[model samples]
Target: MNAPVATSLLHPEFVQRPVPEALVQALATRFGSQCSTALAVREQHGRDEGAIAAPPPSAVVFAESTQDVQDAVRLCAQHGVPVIAYGAGSSLEGHLLAVEGGISIDVSRMNRILSVNTEDLTVTVQPGITRKQLNDAIKDTGFFFPIDPGADASIGGMTSTRASGTNAVRYGTMRENVLSLEVVTANGEVIRTGNRAKKSAAGYDLTRLMVGSEGTLGIFTEITVRLYPLPEAVSAAVCSFPSIEAAVHTVIQTIQVGVPIARVELIDVNSVRMVNAYSKLSLREEPMLLMEFHGSPTGVKEQAEMVQEIAGEFGGNAFEWAERPEDRTRLFTARHNAYFAAVSSRPGCRCITTDACVPISRLADALLDCVTEADASGIPYFLVGHVGDGNFHFGYLINPDSEDERTRAEQLNQQLVQRAIALGGTCTGEHGVGIHKQGFLREEAGDGAVQMMRAIKQALDPQNILNPGKIFTLQ
Candidate 1:
């Protein structure tokens, strides 16, 4: 048990397949000014928001189109070199780390809305487009993509990680929102997984398979996603609770009672304090539920009233409403920045983040004990969750220079994942099982299921050139 955590803490020592000089020259000749070997650019593409450390990729290829991605991948495949896909670089689980030395194919320049089909309620976009960019572009059409994963993460990356955020409890995650994809296979072949039809009796469900593949199975070039119409009326509210359990129980009851709450998030007292200091807002320093309701004015009012009554049963304070658009934006912006706020609370500290999601019935049982354990561990941390779906995160802040701190934090994370799995939940909720959660993934999925996944990976990417050394090691 300790061994897995230790392995997770140390940077993976996979055999680094050297990027042959011939391949580098080929990339330079093909891509011309688009290929860069400069140290700064390589370093920038090497790591992400995750704490894991690894040497920068040998080169960074800026892919501006689907053909560019295909060309870069083809060149790498010929040389048997690893390829790591880069987007907004906002993934929290080390998903973008170039663990086995390779070249990073950055798709940020490929950002563009290919088409918007209002009648179909779907939008086709290049992988590089961020969620915020997509929403801003489609806002005037009375439709918006609802997968808001806090950061302005790329649609491609979000789709790759199968991310869902504040709106997931209502609109669903990337797994449900993504209708189809144009993917570049390991051998540089482009394939369309499905069409924009809402339902299909296809031979295989490749779209779902690729949605959360973490860039291991293939590279995404184009994505078609379902969109929701902007609500006729929306309201945001914050209600404080006397204790963490009370706040969690309120969410559990809200969910169990079928409140149809659009977005419901849990922010612990520690995180609220951090947000207060970082965002310069005086939210009550107590466990709080930040909620949103969307529908007709009457429907929204009824939902809010029902939730307020439920909160009252759990010793919650009065609801502070944010009905105006700007006010709601300000409140949600602060919620989105909870991660940065926690990081800012402790200067020079790195966070060992935990994503543990249990069943709604087990949320209180899973969360309360973990809270007690975290407090007793003497680690400064912040707890926040999209608890409307029984998914929560604990960001354990630790000194980068202290091995003991890292070990302690990993231990806490291990325990948290164990409890969540025991409660019939996943090791990761929105964050995919990047390098960080590979051990927990095996525990959750069992050896036989993992072997089946390995077989699929072997069949799709025989050379292991696509984002090698992620999810689970091939060996």
Candidate 2:
């Protein structure tokens, strides 16, 4: 293990990378009480939600402001030490693993809503604020941030991963929601990019450059995200289908017909069963579409009627709608708990969440075939999707001690990813590659594109000090 976080060395690779002790001393002196070398704390913050391995960080720093990030980064640059930016520790792709251990800068404290520009429909917030926190703060303002990445993730981590969930089908992902950023470049200078205005004739869209960069190019201090007006009329509905194909086809046709669906989600029969047993959600045990319509009362009425007609043509079960605030809350809460239900299907088992997206026309075929494949494999897998976007997740459960099962699951995951690539879709629609997709990046983005990304990395972080050994390996 590294000189720091010498504890939690049960795994061979956890924080074993070399770190300069003199650099740590210098940083410690500079940050004083703000810096910490406590092994337990560092270990706690370093773990990610990856199935491969979750390593701990060597050191930890609770950053209070952008200046603190600058001080820590400058020290790491001088010493050529790796720095890992820690968020809420909810990264499913091992994005926060301190592979080359040094200091893990935790931005949990810098969570303040700097400004809510209602005129521009944007909210400027410190990256550390969680999505739920942001929503709660702006609940009374009639504006909401809508990227729901499953986890109550920090805005910074979500931006780093370009994360999204059910709401993205209507509200869009981080790439679409983020309007600008206050980022600290490798040189430790905090600068602002993008503007409060909706459109910009600016030179380069550097604001978006950092959205999915995963902290490789720079550190995000503040994020300005586009917000949506709370719907004047809203309703949630569930439409059960006889088969996955029928449900997917319904989603496609609903969108094709110009139905302004806010969230159209699919849960296969197996997934519904898991949620019923685990979350005590007594919904019908069938392939179902959980949908939301947002607009004026007349618009919502028209959209709901059109959606119901489409579902009926496909032999869908009777559709049920919830419009009251309490009913809406209950419906969405159950929807959000789909992941927990999948994991709890096998008590005390870790989850393997594999996500992908395909063209809307091909979504039905892909999902139907995947359900067949999942059933044939005889593994516990839950099928759920943001139907309107053709992006879905197969949440698989495996006991940590079952090596053979884990290996089989890995093979299944590889097959799924390959299938998605063949269909002209991304291996990960919203989740950043992190360590999980490093090998597959080339198969998606060609060698030349990868090379350019590496060149940018070298230029920004000459010392390879800011979140090193991520996005691309230093050659």
Candidate that scores best on TM-score: 1
Q: Scored by CA lDDT, what does every candidate get? A: 0.92, 0.82
Candidate 2: pairs in clash: none
Q: How many angstroms is residue 326 displaced in model 2 relative to the true structure, after the best TM-score fit?
A: 1.8
lDDT of 1 by residue, 244-281 (tens): 89988998899888899999999999999999999999
How many residue pairs clash in all the candidates, one count each?
A: 0, 0
RMSD in angstroms between candidate 1 and the native structure over all alpha carbons: 2.2
Task: Compose the digit string of candidate 2's lDDT tens values, residues 1-475.
Answer: 1232211112334344567789878878888888888878977877777675655666788899999999888877777777888889888777787777778999999899999988889999998999999999999999989898778899999998889888987888998889889988888888898888778987978877788998898889999998889989998898898888899999999888877799998998878898788767788998999999889999999899999999999998869988888987777777778888777778888877788899888897777777777788777888888979989888778887887667767777777887888888888887778766776677778899999988888887787777766666766
Q: If scored against the real structure, what TM-score would every candidate get?
A: 0.98, 0.94
TM for candidate 2 is 0.94
Candidate 2: worst-modelled 10 consecutive residues by lDDT: 1-10
Which ranges in model 1 have alpha carbons more than 4 Å from their true place? 1-7
